[model samples]
Target: MVNPYGPDTRGTFSFGIRLGLLFEVQAACLSAICVVGLLVYLGWTAIRTRRQRGKHALPSHLHVLFVSLLFSDLLHSIGSILNIPWIRDSGVLEGPLCTAQGIFRQMGDTGVALEILAIAVFTWGVIVRGWSSPSLKTTFVIVGLIWIFVILITLVSYGVHKAAGQVYYGNTRYWCWIRSPYSLPDGIALQYGWFWLTAAINLVLYISVAVTLLKSKRRCRNAQMPEGQRSLQKIAFQMTWYPIIYLITITPMSITRLWIFTNPEHPPPFAATALAAVLLTLSGVFNAVLFSITRPTLIPQKGHDHDPTVGGLRSIYTLEFCQRPDEDQRSSKIPPSPETPCHGEGTSKGGGTDETYV
Candidate 1:
């Protein structure tokens, strides 16, 4: 029996279907493992950080970014996991499942964009201020504002299309995503506008982060302490990977989109689409792994020299800074403790001696 919705053997669609299925299966397996690992790592770190909250200064901003990245990657992985079975059976974009898949895909897409933006901002903050980056209040406010803005833009674009009696429906697909073959001017404009907006934002943030890291490294080179050089080097390496991965994942899509726009008569090379999907999928996994490896603090393990005690102490001051004036005053009202000598310091009784402040 002939399959109407199946891949066309004469064209690249057949090859694309095969390739996408292969990649999706591999991605699903890898992503499933990664998701489990991430969840375990996140749980372990959260518990450890919480226990040592008083003794160690936590990198709260970095933690926020880490959480966001994990969440986004998890969502992306979920989308892939769902799509893999569909693709394997050649049932993608069919029935109600297509709409469900589209919703998940959109969710993953938005999550990924927000994750990248959050990481960029977090990295930039670190490069600029190091230990004195913006307070949690400021970071939260900024993230909230960015999310709200993106949501508004998506709604407006969606509404405009629907109002024009251009509500797109598909026989091959169930989701209401912007239909492909965007030959119409309005369709092309919307598609390109989103593409460029995301890419531009990513480029600007990454460039800023790279520049800042470079400048910091140069400054550290002239400093007396060699430890500064090591710290700066680590940061430099981590910051560099982000832009590299971003370009690797997005460049193919950018080129393909441009080519299709310029040469409307020809369809985009199927290889490009396949490459883009694979690279983007891998990017999510890579980001999660890179962060965990680079920032050892994010992964809690025994025998690691990185102390959470100092991080906890730092968190206190940072938290204080983020609180309201009245709350700050209330916190400040706590009396300072008198100096005390340890039990083993002097006395045979093994008791400490307390001395009052002058």
Candidate 2:
């Protein structure tokens, strides 16, 4: 293949650039929606919780999980703001500009993958051990560590490319990224070593979560736990959908990239690249809808919050705390119909939010 900035021998640039730009731009628009929507949601949550003044504290752990995701998604979306007009006019960017774009894109890509894996672990922790929400200090620590890791890994790619003395962030097909990542050491590390490994781990974690849920169900079979208190629907939805959607969206790009590596003699199809570009670019958007917008439906509303012992002692004495949610949910006292528990109820709290989580 000819260098994107070099001679135009392969005739690849003619069709590839325009097609890639078109799809990427569309994906950028969707990415914008994802970022804006998430920010609004986070802001609203913060203000609402503040007004409540500790009366209705939000779940810190869940907040950390989603906020970290938002940060990663924002990075992913930022890379979508390509200099289309500039690119069309100049036909090539300066080396530094190209390098920056490449780095930014990879940060977003790997960041999202890593964040998803984090979420899987979070779900498992809450389910298997009745883990509480993270403290404010812990939240910052986790987020900081994630960013630090991202920065270090991205720098590794940059260092490798610099050492090669080749044009770093050279134009690949239509866009800028680590060129020939499958072949180059730095590129391969970013793509194959980091990104793929995260996705693989996420798969394993989710599968483990599913199996654990089944075993838990068997253990609590005799208990009269409300279905909502079991949080089966919510857990099942995430455990099933999160990994599945991620795999589905990422497969096309993974396949196309690997194919190019294995079979360089034949060029990849334009249609395949277009599909991959759409999926890659809109990943943030899909995640916002799946992980953010639709997630609240699973949380039990304050008024609708079901008391695990609503039916009286007949059910309470026989109910297993193992099958019940957090301790606040197991409390025998009758809470006012409109009053939220001081402690947060987890997914197993009969749709109630974690009360002690505050």
Candidate 3:
């Protein structure tokens, strides 16, 4: 009589398997907890302040983007949390349930790409093209477009999964994403394929913003322009590090997975796979830190509708860095610091550095 759950554990050590599985579970669980807390707080604040902004108000930069991003993170973290039990126990989940998990995982992965791409595009618009704040309706429209994009792509993948059958979670990947996550008949076309394209678009936009900012900064210094009127690129740079950080953190997983795809005969070291799992799982945590979800809102009275009397700068190019003595009575956060390059950026998530790996 053959055992139905067939115990063919060749080339897989029991202790090593247990340890690796435990680590993956812990990373995903912990990351989920930390990131979800941030998401909750952000969502609550957005809801509470909705009416306070007055009617027909347009909030400062990318209000919809932050909220949409938190939703995606929530989906990501929750999917991981639910999968812990499934991954640890021996058995298959209900068909529709597994299908739901696959969709949620795709939502998070694809959703992130759209979010970062939106931010990068936003940065380019403000810096290069002199675009200003988008109205509330316009912002919601953008949010709708992103969500729709993710859903359509996810359905495409789900269609493929139903046709293929076996392997929904934890075949090649440790977490609860589509199995053989970065490979294919279907994986590349659905999952990992988006990785490189998103990364490339982000890099180009970041470079453009960085160069434009530096040039503007130097010109301001030479001409002795009023300090208050300098471009806010340095500070803006802080908020723009997400795409860069995302790329840096995901590179390890990408490289290792590619190697496995190319050299299937010789399995890569368990350690390599473990490192990748660790980084990928901690992604939401990094996003929370980068966005400063725990800190005070950077733009005050932001939720209230736009007041024409508000003296905020017209575009990022003309944004003021130094506060004038007259405006000191106001509750502005940006401070004066002429000598240091990246100084005055509060340790808030807006600082142009990433703590994701750390």
Name the top lDDT candidate: 2
Best-fitting candidate, measured by TM-score?
2
- Candidate 2 per-residue C-alpha lDDT over 247-268 given as tens digits, one digit per residue, 9 for 90 to 100: 8777888888778667766768
Q: Give the local distance difference test score of model 2.
A: 0.59
- Worst lDDT 10-window in candidate 3: 349-358
Candidate 2: the clashing residue pairs are 229-348, 229-350, 343-355, 343-356, 344-354, 344-355, 344-356, 345-353, 345-354, 345-355
List per-prediction Cα lDDT, in the order shown.
0.49, 0.59, 0.57
User: In lDDT terms, how accurate is model 3?
Assistant: 0.57
lDDT of 3 by residue, 150-189 (tens): 8887776566656785444333333334555334445566
| Total colliding residue pairs, candidate 1 | 10
Question: Estimated TM-score per prediction?
Answer: 0.67, 0.74, 0.71
